[model samples]
Target chain A: MIGIVDHGMGNLMSVRNAFEYIGAEAKVCREPGELAGADLLVLPGVGAFGDCMRNLRHRNFVAALDEMVIGSGIPILGICLGMQAMAKRSFEGGEHEGLGWLDADVVRIRPAGREYRVPHIGWNDVTFEGNNPLFADLPADPVFYFVHSYHVQCRNSGDLAATCDYGGTVTAAVRKGNIFGTQFHPEKSQDQGLRILENFVRQGGQC
Target chain B: MLKKRLIPKLQMKKSRFGNRMVLVTTVRFDEVMEIGDPVSQAKIYQAQAADELVFLDLDASVENREPVTDYIRRAAEELFMPLTAGGGVKTLDHFRMLLENGADKVSINTAAVENPELITRAYEAFGAQCVVVAIDYRQDADGREKVWIRGGRTGTGLDPAEWAEKAERLGAGEILLTSIDRDGTREGLDLETTRRVADAVTIPVITSGGCGLACHFSEGFLTGKADAVSAGTYFCFKDENPMQTRSQIRNAGIPIRIQT
Candidate 1:
C-alpha cells in the first residue's frame, strides 16, 4: 500500500484521488502508526513552511518520517510545500528548519526582471537533469502546474533531478536515493503530471 | 518556460429542460442560453488535455444558493487537470467546502469586492495559491472602466486596474478578469482593459469573455499579455473545442503542452 503522510497541511485528497485514478492503493495516513504497512510513502503538503513544520511536530510526524525514510530506507515523495519541507531550512515566514533529508535549502524565488511574476503560478516545463526512476517513460520535458513563491536550492548538484526556467533555472524536481520531491503539483499537471505520479507508483516496489 | 494556458469557461445553471446541470452563456451577464451539459463538455476538454478548467456557477450568487459542489465533485472525478470553481463564494467555509469537494481553486468575485478582508483571511488560511479573486468589469456610459458585483448587475465604480492591484496585495494568487461588454459577443476580448489589468498586477491574470475565435486566444496572450485565456460562448456555441482551439493557438507559435 502507498501511504500518504497527512499532517493536516497538504491537499491530501487530490493526491489520494490521483493515486486512486492511476490504480494505486493509497490511503491518507494521519497517524504515524498507520504508515507501518506501506512500502512507499508520499509526504504531501501546502501552506507556509513554518506552519507545516509546526504541524508535523505537533502530530509527532518528524521522528516517524525520519525512521521510515532514513532508517528503514522507505522511498518517499514530497509535493510543493512538502518538497520544500524536505530541505534543511526555509526563509519563508522567518527561518524554519526542515526535514533535512536532502542537502538543500528553500528560498523565495526572485524574479529575473520586471517581465517575470512572483509565485510563478502556471504550467511550466520540467527539464530532466539525469536519469531517475521517477521520470521514467515520461516526456523529455513535461509541463507541471506550479504555485509557489519559494523553491528548493540543492547543495549537491547531483541530487537535482529536473529544473524549470521561471526567472532563471529553478529547481523543479529533486531525487536523492529513495527520497523524491517536486516543486510542482503533479496531481494538477494533467496527463504529464499523472504520468509522473504513475511512474512514481511503478517505482515503489523497486525502491 | 511556462506554457500559456487554454482554459474552457463553463457557466453552470439548472437545465431549462430538466433538473440536470447544463452549460450556459450570457450576454452582459443576462439572457442565459443553455448550450450543453458541463460534465460531458468538461470530459471532452480533459481528453484534449486543456491546461485548466473554470466553472462559474451562474445561478449560485444570484439565486443565493451554494455553489454547485456536486457538479464540481463529479467533474473532478474524471478530469485530472486543475479545476477552478467560482461564483457565490461568500465565506472561508465556502472556499473550504469547494476545495474539500475536489476543486483545486476557489474564485470569489462579489464577496471579495464587498469584503476585501476575506481575501486576506482566505489566503492566510489556505495559502495564497488557492485563493483567486475574479473581477467582472465593464465600461460605464461615461466610458470609465468599472468593477461590477453580483453577477455584473451592480456596478461598484471601482477601477478594475486598481482593484486588481489591491487583490494581489491582499494575497490573491490569481485574478480572473471578465469583460462584461464583450461577454458572449464573440468580438474578441477587451484587449485594452485586459492589458491594463494584467499590467497592474504581478500575479497571473486570466482574461475571460469576448472570445470569438481561436486567434483571439493568441491575441490575449501575445498582445494582451495575459497568463491564461478563458472562453465561454466561443467554446460553447461555436464548432470549436479545446483541441481545435489549442491547435490554432499552438499554430500561432505559442508553445502549449500537447497530450500524447
Candidate 2:
C-alpha cells in the first residue's frame, strides 16, 4: 500500500487520484498512527518549507516518519516542497531547518539573466542522471509540470537523479538509498509523469 | 528551459437557478456563446494533449462559491492536467479551498485590483507560484490601454503594463494578460500590448484574447514574447484543437510539449 502523508499542504487529491488512476491502492493517511501498515510512504507538499516541518511535528507525524523511514527503512518519495522538506535547511522566507534526510538546501532560483524568469512555471524536460529506478521505461522526451521558485541544491553529487535546463542545470529529481524526490510534480505531468509514478511504485526504492 | 504552454480557457457559469455548470465563451467581452459541458470538454482537451486548462468563473459572486467549487472538484477528479481557476477569489480561504479541492493555481482579476494587499497575503501563505493576477484591459480610441474590471464592464484607468509591473512586485508568479478588444476577434493576438507587458515584468506572462490562425500561436511566443498563449473561441468555434495548434507552434521553432 502507498500511504500519502498528509502534512496539511498542497493538492493531496491530485496525488491520490493519480495513484488511483494507475490502478494502485493509495490512501491519504492523515493520522500519524496510520503510518505503520504501508509498504511505501509518499510525502507530497506545495507550501512553505518551515510550515511543512511544523505541521509534521505538530500533527505528531515526525516521530512516525522517522520510525518508518529511518528505523524500518521503508521506501519514501517526496514531491515538490515535500522534496525540500527532506533537505537539511532552506533559505526561503528566512532561514529554516529541514528534516535532514538529504544533505541539501532550498534556495531561490536566481536566473542567469533577467529574461530567464523566476518561478520556472510550465512544462520542462528532465534528463535522468544515474540508473535510478524512477526513470525506468519513461519516454525519451520526458517533460513534467513545474511551478516553483525555490529549488533543491544537493550537497552530495551522488544523490542527483535528474536535471532540467532552466537558466542553467536545475536539479529535477534526487534519490538516496530508500529516499526519492522530484522537484517537478509527476501527478500534474500527464503520461510521462504517470509513468514515473508507476516506476516509483514498482521499484523497491533501489537504484 | 520551460516550454511554452497552449492552454484552453473555459468560461464557465451555472445556468440561472440551475446546478449544472455550462461552458461558455465570450466575443469581445460582450456576446456570450454557450459551448458545452465543462467536464466533457476538459476530457477532450486532455485527450488532445493540452498542456494545461484554465477555468474562469464568470459569476464569481460570493453567493455562487458553493456551485463553483462543486464543478471544480468534479473536473479535478476527471482531469489530471494542471488546472488554474479564477474569478471572484477575494480572500485567503478561497485559495485554500480551491487548492484543497485540486486547483494547482488560482487567478484573481477584480479582487486583486480592488485589494492588492490580498496578493501579498496569498503569496505569504500559499507562495507566489499559486497566486496568478489576471489582468484584463482594453485599448481606447486614442490607443491607450487601461485595465478593465467586472468582466470588462468597468474601467480602472490603470495601464496594463504598469499594473503588470506592480503585480509582479507584489508577489504574483504569473500574469494572465487578456486584451478585451481582441478577444474572440480571430484577427490575431494583440501583440503590441502583449509585448509591452511581457517586457515590463520579469515573471512569466500568459497572453490571451486573440488566437485565430495557426501562425498566431507562434506569434504570441516569437514576437509577443509571452510564455503561454490561450484561446477560448478559436478552439471552441474553429476546428483547431490543441494537438494541431501545438504542431503549428512547434513547427515555428517554439519549444512546446510534444503531442502524445
Candidate 3:
C-alpha cells in the first residue's frame, strides 16, 4: 500500500486518484500513525514553499516523514512543491528551512537574456540524465506538466536525474537512493504521468 | 524545451437528462449546440494526449449559479492532463472550491472584470500559476478592442491590450483571449487582436475562438504570437480529435507534443 502524506497544502485527491488509476492501493494519510502500515510514501503539495513547510510542521509530519523515509528506508516520492521541500531551504517568500534530505536549494528560475516567462506553465519535454527506475519504460524526453516559478538547484550533480530546458537548464527530476522527487506533477501529465506513477509503485516494492 | 500547446476547449451545460453535464458548443457565447458527454469527451482528449483541457460552465454565468464542481470532479478522475475550469467564478471561495474539486486552474472572466481584486486575491491564495483570466472581446465600430463581461452580453469599455497588461501586473499567470467576432465563424482566429494582447503581456497567452482548420492553430502561434491555441467548434463540429489536429499543426512546421 502507498501512503500519501496530506498536510493540508495542495490537492491530495489527484495524487490518490492517479495511484488508484494504476491499480495501486493508495490512501490519504493525514496523521503520522497512518504512515506505519505503508511501505511506500508520497509527499504531494502545491502553493508557496514557506506555507507548505509551515503546514507540514504544524501537522507534525516532519519527524514522522523522516522516520519513515530515512529511518525505515521506505521509498518515497515528492511532487512539485513537495519535491522542493526536500531541499535544505527556499527563497520563495523568504528564507525558510526545508527537510534537507537532499543537498539542494530552491530559488526562483531566472532565465538569462531571454523572453522566457516565470511560473513556467504548460507541457514541456524532460530529458533524462541517467537511468533511474522512476522513468523506466518511458520514452526518451517525455513531456510533463510544469507550473512553478522556483526550481531545485542540486549541490551534488550525481543527485540530478533529469532536466527540462526553459531558457536555462531547470532541474526537472532528482533521485538519491530510495528518495525521489520530480518538479513536474506526474498526476497531471496524462499517460506519461501514469507510467511514472506505476514505475514508482513497482520500484517501491523492490526497495 | 516548452513547445506550443494545442488545447481543446470544452463547454459544459446542464444536460437535458436533468442532472448530468453535457458538452455544448457556443457561437459568440450564445446559440448552444450539444455535442456529447463531458466526461467521455475528456477521456478521449486524454487518450489523444491533449496538452491541456479547458472546461467552461456555460450556464453558470447566465443562470447565476456556481460552476459544476461535480462535473469537474468526474472529468478530473479520468484525466491526467491539466484541467482549467471557468465560468461564473466570482469569489475566492469559488476558486478554492474548484481547486479542491480537482481543477488544476480556474479561469475568471465576469468576476475579474467586476472586481479586479478578485484576480489578485485568487492569485495570492493560490499561486499566480493557478489563476487564468479569460478576456472575451470584440472590435467596436470604431475598431477599438473592448472587453466583454457576463459571457459577452455586456461591454466593459476596457481595451483588451490595457486589460491584459493590468491582469499580468495583478498576478495572472496566463491570459485566455477569446475573439468574439471570429468565434464560431469558422474562418480563423483574430490574429491581429491576439497579437495585440500577446505583445502586451509577457506571460503565456492562449488564443481561443475562430479555429476552423489546423492551419489556424499554426497561424495563431506563428503570426498571432500566441503561446497556445484553443478551439471548440473545430474539434466538436468536425469529425476530428486533438491527435489529428496536433499532427496537422506539426506538419505545418510548428512543434507540438506527439505522445507515443
Candidate 4:
C-alpha cells in the first residue's frame, strides 16, 4: 500500500485519487504514525517551500519520517514543493531548513534571459541522464506538467537523474538510493505521469 | 521546451435531469447548447491527446454556487489530465472547496472583478498556480473591450488588458481571455484584444472565443502570442479533436506537444 503524507499546504485529494486510479491502494495519512503500515511513502505538496517545511515540522513528521524512511529503508517519492522540501535548505521566503535528505537547495528560478517567465508552467520535456528504474519503459524525452518558481540545485552530481531545458537546464527529477523526487506533478501529467507513478509504486516494493 | 497547448474546454450546465453535469456549447457567451456527458467527452479528448482539459460551469451564480465539483471528483478519479474548473466562484472558501474536491486550479471570473482582493486571499491560501482569473470580454460600440461577468450577463467598465495586469499584480498565475464578439461565429479569434492582454501581462494568457479552423489556433500562438488556446464551440460542434488540430498546428511550423 502507498501512503500519501499530507503536510497541510493544500489539498492532497488529487494525489490519493491518482494513485487509486492506477489500481493502487493509497491512503491520505495526516499523521506520521498513520503511515506505519505503508511500505512506501509519497510526500505530495503545493505552495511555498518554507510553509511546507513548517507544516511538516508542525505535524511532527520531520523526525518520524526520518526514522521511518531512512532508518527503515522504505522508499519515498516527493513531488513539487515536497521534492524541494527534501533538500538541505531553501531560499524562498527567507531561509528554512528542509528534511535534509538530498544535498541541494531550493532557490527562485532566475531564467538565463528575461524573455522566459518566472513560473515555468505547462508541459516541458525531460532528458534522462542515466539509466534509472524510476523512468523505466517511458518514451524518450517524455513531457510532464511543471508549475513552480523554485527548483532543486544538487551539490552532488550523482544525485541528478533528469533535467529539462527551460530558459536554462532546470532540474526536473532526482533519485538517490531509496530517496526519489520529481519537480513535476505526476498526478497531473497525463498517461506518461501515471506510468511514472506506477513505476515508483512497483520499484518501491523491491526496495 | 514549453510547447503551446491545444486545450479542449468543457462548458458545463446541469442536465435537464438536473442531476448530472453535461457538456455544453455557448454562442456569444449566453446561449447554452447541451452536447453530451463530460466524462465521455473527456475520455475522447484523452484518446485524442488533448494537452489539457478545462471545465467551466456556466450556470453558477453568487447565490447559487453550483460548481462542477461532483463531476470533477468523478473525472479526477478516472482521468489523469490537469483540470481547471471555474464559474460562479466568489469566495476563497469556494476556491478551497473546489481544490479539495479534485480541481487542479480554480478560475474566478465574477469574483475577480467584484472583489479583486479575493484573488490575493486565494493566492495566499493556495498558490498563484491554483488561481486562474478567467476574463470574459465583449467589444462595445466604441470598439473598447469591456470585461463581462456572471457569464457575460453583467458588464464592467474594465479593459481586458488593464484588468489582466491588475489580476497578475493581485497574484493571478494565468489569464483565460475569451472574446464574446466572435464566440461560436467561427470567423476567427480576437487577435487584437488577445495581443493587447498578452503584452500587458507577464503571465501566460490563454486566448479563447473564436476558433473555427485549426490554423486559427496557430494564429493565436504565432500572431497573438498567446501561451495556450482554449475553445468550446469549435471542438464540440466541429468534427475535430486535439490530434487533428495539433497536426495542423505542427504542419504550420508551430511548436506543439508530440503526443506519446
Against the true structure, whose DockQ is highest?
2
lDDT of 2 by residue, B1-260 (tens): 68999999998877765677788988888788888888889889999998999998877643436326766788788787889989879889999888888999999988899999999999888888899999999988788999998888788999999999999999998999999999988889999899999999999999999788989989999999999998898888658899988988888988999844
Model 3 lDDT at residue A73:
89
- Residues B1-260, model 1: lDDT tens digits: 78888888988886656446788989878888877879888888887677888998877787887766777888877788788998899998898888877888899999998899999999888888888899998988998999999888888999999999999999999999999989999899888988999899888899988988889999999889998999888877558878888888889999776663
* Cα shift from native, residue B131, model 4 (Å): 0.6
Candidate 4, residue B80: Cα displacement in angstroms equals 0.6
| Shift in Å, residue B214, candidate 3 | 0.8
Off by over 4 Å in 4: none
**Candidates 1 and 3, the one with greater DockQ:** 3
DockQ of each: 0.65, 0.80, 0.70, 0.68
- Cα lDDT of model 3 by residue, B1-260, tens digit: 78889888998888877678889888877788888988888877777878898998877887888776888898877788788999889888898899888898999998888899988888778888889999999989998889998888889999998999999999899999999888888899999989988889888999989998788899999999998999888888658788898988889888788883
Expressed as tens digits, the lDDT of each residue in A6-60 for candidate 1 is 8876577788888999999998988898988898999888778988998899989
lDDT at A96, model 4: 90
The residue pairs found clashing in candidate 3 are: none
Q: lDDT score, residue B97, model 4?
A: 76
DockQ class, candidate 3: medium
In order, the interface RMSDs are: 1.5, 1.1, 1.4, 1.5
